[model samples]
Target chain A: MKVLKGAYSGLIFLFLYAPIVVLIAFSFNGAKSRGAWGGFSFRWYESLAQNADILHALRNTLIVALLSAVVATIIGTAAALGMHHMRRGLANFMLNVTYLPVLNPDIVTGISLLILYVFIGINLGFSSLLLAHITFNIPYVILSVSPRLKGMNRHIFEAALDLGAGPVRAFFKVIVPEILPGIVNGFLLAVTLSIDDFVISFFTAGPGVSTLSITVYSMARKGIKPEINALSSIMFVVVLLLLLTVNIRAGRDIRRRAQTHVRSHSPRALSSREH
Target chain B: MSELIRLVNCVMAFDDVTVLNSINLTIKDKEFLTLLGPSGCGKTTTLRIIGGFEVPTSGDVFFDNVRINDVPPYRRRVNTVFQRYALFPHLNVFENVAFGLRVAKVPKADIERRVRESLDLVGLRGYDKRASHQLSGGQQQRVAIARAIVNHPQVLLLDEPLGALDLKLRKEMQIELKRIQQQVGITFVYVTHDQEEALTMSDTVVVMNDGVIQQIGTPVDIYNEPKNAFVADFIGESNIVPGVMHRDCEVSFAGRVFRCVDTGFAPDEPVDVVIRPEDVRLSPPEEGQLDGEVLSVTFKGVHYEMMVRARDFTWMIHSTASEPVGARVGLSVRPFDIHIMHRAEKTEAAS
Candidate 1:
């Protein structure tokens, strides 16, 4: 049974990552063709570094993702805070409304945003793409943050006020610290999703505002570019590093919280350190 | 002691249900007064009103003879040790204790000195670096107390601060709390449902029920002279039986006329008779005032608790002697042991 379970997990992992493994391996190939691996070399990477169009696309992707993630996180966290204090029924209604953007098909959101921008007489370019990314990224941020707010002790806010801190000071000193991990997680999720998005960017992004994903798609339409493989490999490693840092920090937080919970409930063992 | 805080006809109604109905109370400086009652009896509501957490629906709250109904909690010189010890989880012991001083913008040196002094008062010296979560329930409770007292408020409100500890820890903290209150020399308005804790710690005990103050007096006064059946039953174990007040110091119950140390009732008026369990003495069936069959008996460490059914009412008697089940026993009470009280107009059974 143990062997079978191990085999099953191994097969699943292989099936999931085999294609990425092949793409990464090919990025180091000297050959220009996908099927023929004429030994390993850094020729494709060297070309990818000097490719102005691809580099420009990479710059656009980073700018759009970072800017949209920041704006979306601020708006979404404020909305979540507002909704956290609402009456239960109203809060539930608003939460369901917030879920609509995440649950709706990306194509639908993209087309609707495109049509709205055209009708509103706004030019479709980098700003339009940025707006679209922010709009879609907000729901992810709110979804991540609302649970932290719910888990918070409701009395801490009142305790802060009772202890001589005003409302604004209490919010920053106590409430923000309590929910900060969730905010950071939401921001990371927004950045990842905005970078990975393609369907929405394709519709909302106008001429000359090509993101990395859109540029790859356009290059793939003509012919599979060997330099694109190197680009994807670097992007994957960057995302992997980002996720590792987040997971490590989150693990430390959970462990510290768990230790506190255990200590609070354990049998009262006085250390005899009385004055 | 002088009056430091007063609630004048304070009424708190949340939506349609009234939590406090025209509560009028005066708290004295350096007095340890406890609000004792079961849950939802408005004891907590009264404490919150004084803490500036709740605005009275239609009445005024006075602190130092100044009406502070509109004053917010931070503006009031009062702090509450919450029931759950709502210590800031992100802060260490020293920082939690120093929270109020930091917000008040006190000097850094003064804040450190006061924080250390308060921690020492709570017997938690050298624990300033420990996080709030790293402490046991008793330690957390001490931290909460230290946090509240470090501010040097004129009055400190504790909402059942020891309600979360185990029996042994609770007993220890009860004494610890009393000593801390005296050392701080601030008026402490404590709230709890435990009558024994109230009796042990408070200089004055305020018994409340159904959003109204049932009785307010010293512990001995509240115990020995309960104004009504609810106060008598709530404060301690008592067998409250109905009786007729025939004349001064005379009442009749359980098919016998008994003399009590009470008077000023209308002639032939119905009254409630309160008899403490420990005060009832056991005697021979023929020699006692009332006789009954013992239904059950259980040893309660210091005393044996026996339930005796006599006439129409069951009496709880605590004695050093044990009476077996189904045994015939006689119960006798002295005239001073029988307390007569005016029957409550709309008495609901004590919870």
Candidate 2:
């Protein structure tokens, strides 16, 4: 039964990832013909390294991602805290409004943001692209952080107040620390979404402020180039490493907290101690 | 005794439902006053109003002589040890205790000294570095107490602080809480649904029901001399025998006449004569006043709880010796132990 289950899982994995594997494999083809299997070569990778336009797009993408992630984290954390304190009906309505950007079609969101920018007389540039990215990224952060806030014990805040803390002090000392992990997780999620954005960036970015995803689309439309494959491979590796790091850190934190909870609440441990 | 806190004609309503109605109470300084009631009887609501978490719909809350109705919870010179201790999971014992002092911007040395002193007072001095979540429920509750008292607030509000513990832990903590209150000499406004807990720890007990104060007096007064049917039924295990007041000092129940010490009721007024189980004596038929057959007998350690059926009603009697089931027994209650209270509807409504 276990072997059969393992086989079933293996088949599902291949079915899901086989297309990506084929794309990566074809990117390394050294033959002149695109369809035929070819010997491996480092020529595509070398060509990718020399592409100054791609490098510039990559830098712009990184800048936009960092800017949007920071802004989204700040705004989303504050919104989560606000919603946490609000009445249930009002909080739910506001949460739905915040998440409208994520649920709306990308093309519609892109067109609307473009119209908004033009109406506001703000020219498309790195700032406009960053703003557009943040509009979508913030909802994800808020969704992530709000649940963590709800799960936290409200008594902690009351305890802080009882211990003589004013409102502002209690928020920073108790509320913030308890929700830090959720904030970090949300920030990373925003960063990933911002970096991978293409359609929204295509509409919002100016000629010289193109992001890496937009550059990749333009390059792919021109021709099926091996250099694009090399670029994608690198981006995929970076994303994989980032996801692994985040998952490991989050898992460790959860495990540590669970162990601490168990140790403190165990009857044997509580009764054995003289104090 | 001087009043430390007073609520004058306090009325609190949530939306259309009134939770506390025209509450007038004066808590004396250094007194342990308990608001005792069944669940959802406005005891907790009253305590929350005193803690400044809830504003009264139309009334004044006074701390000493100052009107504090508009004060926010953080600004009130009162602290509440919540039913759930609500200790900060991320902070250690010392930091939890020191949080208020730190927020007040006290110096580091002073914060350390006060935190240590508070922890020592709660018998947790050596566990300073232990995380709040790394403690048992009882320990967490003690830490909560230490955290509140460290601020030296004028009044400490405890809202069922020991309700979550096991029986053994609860009894132990009750004694500990009494000792701590005596040592601190701060006004304690405790709210609980547990009648025994209120009776054991309170200097004064306020019995409330359905958003109105039923009675307010010392624990003995509230328990032994309940003023109405509700108060008599709620405070302890009572065999309420519905009867008619024959005269000023006489009541007729179950086709029999008994003399009671209570007076002030008009002739032929419907009343309930409350006899506590422990106060009713069970003996052989010749030595007792009422004769009945034992329906059941439950051994409760030092005493036997016997239920005797007399005429149309059953009465619970506690005795030193066990009475066999189906055995004829006699029940005798002292005239002083027979507390007579008027029917609830006839009493004047509190305004």
Candidate 3:
């Protein structure tokens, strides 16, 4: 049974990541031919370094990702707070509206946003792309944050208020800290989503505002390039590092909280013994 | 004595259903007043109204002769130690206690001194830096108390504050709370469903049922002279026998005429006779007021609870003596121990 389980897990891993592995392997191939694997070489890495358009697109992608992540986090946190205080029916309705952009197909959202921009006579550029990314990214932030808000003990807020801190101060000193982990997780999710997006950007992004994903698509359409492999490898590594750092930080924070909880409760056990 | 807070004909309704109806109470300064009731009897609702968390419908809340009906919870000169303690998880004991001071914009040095003093008062002197989430349930409760008392509000409201603790912890905290009340000398409006807690802690006990004040008196007065069936039943364990009031100070129950100290009831008025378990005594069959067979005997740590079956009803009597099951026994109750209350109407009975 254990052997069967091991084989099943192995098959699942292959199904999930085999394409990515193949892509990475091909990127490192030193062969002149496209299909055949070659001995490992540094040609792709050098070509990737010299690519100006790819670098520009990467910079634009980073800017858009960072901007969207910040805007989404602020708006989503506020939305979460508003929803947390709202009546159940109204909150749920608002949540459903926020999630519509996420649930709808990318093509439909992209087209609708394009039409709205045209009707309003708004120019589509980096700003428009960032706005589109935020529209879709906020729902993920809200979903992530709402649960954390709900999980938090409401007594904390009441306690702060009772202690004479006004509503605003209590939100910053108590409510925000309690929900910080959720906020960080949501921010990371938004950043990842913004970075990897292509379909929405394709419709909203104007000339000279191409992102990394757009650059990758255009490059792939022309033909496979060795430099593309290096770029993909770099993107994969950066994302993996970001995920690792966030997970580690989150895990540490959880452990610290648990430790503090245990330590505080332990003194009672000691006092009982003394009594 | 000056009236610290008063609820005049206070009525609270939620979704067209009355939760608190016509609650009239005047809490005196420096009095430990408890609102006692069974679950969902609106004791908590009344406390919430006084704390300014819930506004009474069609009534007035007065604080020191000033109408406070429109006052928000933060603006009320009262603080509540919520049932769950509600200590801020993010703030340490010091910061949590000092939060109100900071919000009121007290000087930093004064805030620090007051926070330290409050923590010391709660016997948590050296643990000020510890986060509230790290504190034990009892410590969390003490922190909650410190948080409230540091502000020195006129009235401190406790909504079953010790209900979450275990028995031993609750007892310890009860004494601590009474001591804190004494030291602070503030009006305390405590709410609880536990009769023992109310009896042990409060100077005045207000027994309530279904949103109405049933009786308000000293703890001894409430326990000794409950005005109605709900008050008698809720204050403690009582054997309520359906009976008829024969005349002034006389009630007949279970084929026996009993002398009671209660009055002002019309003759032949249907009533319920209340006798606490500890008030009834067991003796030889011929030496007591009534004779019955012992249905069961339960050994409580300090007393033996004997269930005596008399006629169609069973009387629970608390005694130290062990009695064999099914043995014939005599049960007697003193006249002063017998409290008579008019029987609840059919609608009240169903509730």
Judging by lDDT against the true structure, name the best candidate: 1
lDDT of 1 by residue, B1-351 (tens): 899998888889999999998898999999999999999999999998888888889888889999999999999999999987889988999999999999999999999999999989999999999888878888999999999999989999999887767777888999998989888889999999999999999999999998999999999999999999899999899999988999999899999999888989999999889999999999878888999989989898999999999987899999999878998888999999999988898753442
Q: What is the DockQ of each candidate?
A: 0.49, 0.44, 0.43
Tens digits of per-residue lDDT for model 1, A1-275: 99999999999999999999999999998999889998989998999889899899999999999999999999999999999999999999999999999999999999999999999998999999999999999998899889788867788898999999899999999999998988998899888888888999999999999999998899989999898899888888878877777677668877877787667655433322211
Candidate 2 Cα errors over 4 Å, as ranges: A15-50, A89-128, A206-208, A249-275, B346-351
Arrange candidates, best DockQ first: 1, 2, 3
Q: Candidate 3 on A100-184: residue-level lDDT in tens?
A: 8789999888889889998998899978888899898899899878977886777777666666667788789889988988899
- TM-score winner among the candidates? 1
When summed lDDT is taken over every stretch of 10 residues in candidate 2 chain B, the lowest stretch is: B342-351
Maximum-DockQ candidate: 1
Instruction: Give the range of the ten consecutive residues with the poorest summed lDDT in model 1 chain A.
Output: A266-275
Model 1, residue A118: distance off in Å is 3.0
In the predicted model 1, the residue pairs found to clash are none
Clashing pairs in 3: A163-B100, A264-B134
Report model 1's interface C-alpha RMSD after superposition on the true interface residues.
Answer: 5.1
lDDT of 2 by residue, B281-316 (tens): 877987878888999989889988888998888998
lDDT of 3 at B291: 94
**Alpha carbon lDDT of residue B208, candidate 3?**
88
